[model samples]
Target chain A: MPRYRAIIAYDGTDFYGWQVQPGKRTVQGELEKAVNQMAKNPEIPIRVQGSGRTDAGVHALGQVVHFDLPYQIPANGVRKGLATMLPFDIGIEQVDIVADDFHAQYSAHTKTYRYQLSNREFRAPFRRNYTGYWPRRLDYDKMAQAIPDYLGEHDWISFAASGFQAKTTVRTVTDVKISQEPATQEITFEFTGTGFLYNQIRIMVGVLLEIGMGTRPVDDIPRLLAAKDRQQARLTAPASGLYLKSVDY
Target chain B: MPRYRAIIAYDGTDFYGWQVQPGKRTVQGELEKAVNQMAKNPEIPIRVQGSGRTDAGVHALGQVVHFDLPYQIPANGVRKGLATMLPFDIGIEQVDIVADDFHAQYSAHTKTYRYQLSNREFRAPFRRNYTGYWPRRLDYDKMAQAIPDYLGEHDWISFAASGFQAKTTVRTVTDVKISQEPATQEITFEFTGTGFLYNQIRIMVGVLLEIGMGTRPVDDIPRLLAAKDRQQARLTAPASGLYLKSVDY
Candidate 1:
């Protein structure tokens, strides 16, 4: 058997999420089905493990996954074959045969996530599936000033949503940045970290947006982190705007 | 009665076309429905007349239309009401009341159309709805060199598609430009003219792409125009990549 690792992209508008569930369409389920068809073995089924799960309607640009195949095939062949079998919304960007001990989930060193905001007065029809809408003026300087506080290692319990059973809340964030396009008024938030807890990025975005909206103080990020209370971050940004930008091993 | 002119945008993937057909979803049909709902008058049904028809799967950024209502209403109110009633794929960008002589189709003016091509080794899932796929390298300079031949008044019979009733084949092309985005490998061709025959822009794009692909000569534009034959311009670009960019009154 040969273990193959692949990087993929998806629209995520129609997918339930990245994980497989009975009677629910997901990225993993669709990819596994394609892989099984290519394997053409009824006795042995192939299972794929993703680096992490992206919630419903969250897109990905370079999601990594590892799976074992019964037969050895060239990486390019596997990429072309899987692409032919997969739906139009999911794309296989790259594939490589990896060592038997390599794992997609545990071996990942860092992950970069991005959140997009369409800060316009009206919702654009073509951008509905890709960006979150914020129909108000945002103080860009205030948001930028608040972003640095999120860096370094901290217990991010305040930003994590309920129901995720993580071993520990301590996570190291390596970098954070925010940029805005003057022509479109689209704001983007980028974060790179060792790992993120469930809904942490979205909850953090909610607080940052509040600060930009002038409803919350500029120094709210440190206070929220110190409180370590999920209730402190009252908003969780919509999943449509979130994207897993890349994973690095 | 108040006559209003509105600039609209649409995804156009699900629409049959810009024109209304029986039992078919269309941009015009949807706009009419919304206008009628707002008018709330059975004696008179409001009809929207677009500046021109965009084929199925052809998007628009600033498509202009004009319609009359039974009662007087503020321009902003009409824009907001119609936007609320229309589907997410179609958008009302700007609306203004105009004089009775103002017309969407017959008004004296210019129209701009743009075609987008995703020139890459693989088709991006997210760009499927908006860009035409061309999985090959293109010579940008060659395409740009051929563009100037398209300017000035000429008999554009070679570029026009069949089945259109036009009084004359003579048309003046005011401007033509080709631009490429290095980061995304997306190429855009924009054309501005007094008017265009049915399927003219798509055929023009086809010829330009052939030039870029090295299949046709860079100086082929003049010969094709002189030939005055549609078959000489055999390639018609996909409708998904075409956009009615704007209209000038």
Candidate 2:
């Protein structure tokens, strides 16, 4: 069997999640269906593996995936085949033939995630679907001062959601960046790390937003980390603002 | 009666156009519905008049409209009231009480329309609704050099769509501007004119796009204008990429 790798992007507003569920519309399910229809034998099932699962309403700019085909087909051919079959919300950004040893999840070295915030008095209707609307003015400097606390290796148990089933909560966060576009009144937070527990990014964003709004002190990140309790960070930002930006292998 | 002027914006994907027709969804219809609901009396009808009628699938960033209310209401109150009643795709950017004599259609001086082109080999699904996908590389210099031909007052019959009902095609085009965002591979064209005939902007954009793609010569603009026939400029661009950007009083 020939192996192929693809970089995918999707507007997750209409999808249940990245994983396949019975009678539900999902990114993985749509990808698999498209692949099966394009396969040499439509009756045979084909499995599509993703780098990680994104929750419902979470978008992706460069999600990586891999799968095997029973017969040979050019990478561009696969892309065109899927492009016509898949829904408009999901797109194949890039496709290439890879070695059999390559794995979408195991071979990943790091991943980057981004969360978008629209900080304005009135949320623009066009942007409501792509950003988390925060009507209050935020202290950008205060938020910047607290971002450094998230750097380095730490047990992110407090940041993870209650239903997270990961065996270990320790993850090495390599970088954190926050950028504000004053013209558009948009704030974007970028996080790069070896891995993240389920819902960790959203929780961190929620706490950071609280700090920016002066509801919490800038030093609360360390306190929450030390507590190692999920209740310490109460708010989980909405999934609409989260994006699986990119993955490294 | 108190007259109110408003700057409206909307994503026109689901709208039939700016005019109201029986059994069809229109921007005018939605605005009227919202205003009528907000009015002091629910049974009485409210008429919303736009500066001009935008073709179906055309969007707007700063469309101007006015309506008379049987009772006086604060500008902010009307905004707030309509905000809850209007659908998410349409929004009011500004509202103010105008003189009783002011009219949305007759009081207008100059109008500006913008056309967006996504000049990339592969169309981005996210931008599909907002831009016309032109997959070929265009000569920006040639397009810019030809823009001057469209300046000043002239009969634009060649640029008007078939079955246009305007009494005269002579209109003063004060300015024509073309800008390209290299990073995003997007090109925008803006035209400021005293007024426009039906489908004039979209037809002009279609000819300019053909010129940019090297299918037509840079001097063809003047030749087409001199032809004084709609068939000379036959390509009418899709309404999806057109926007009624602004109107000057």
Indicate which candidate wins on lDDT.
Answer: 1
True contacts kept of 1: 0.65
Every candidate's DockQ is 0.71, 0.51
Model 1 C-alpha lDDT per residue in residues B131-224, reported as the tens digit of each score:
9988878899999999989998999889889777799999999999899998999999999999998899989999998999999999999999
How far residue A5's Cα lies from its native spot in candidate 1, in Å, is: 1.8
Error of 2 at A9 (Å): 2.0
Docking class of 2: medium
Question: Chain A vs. true chain A, TM-score per candidate?
Answer: 0.98, 0.98
Model 2: runs farther than 4 Å from truth? none
Residue B220 in candidate 1, Cα distance off native in Å: 2.6
Give the TM-score of each candidate: 0.94, 0.93
Residue A111's lDDT in candidate 2 = 100
Worst 10 residues of 2 chain B by lDDT: B37-46
Candidate 2, clashing residue pairs? none
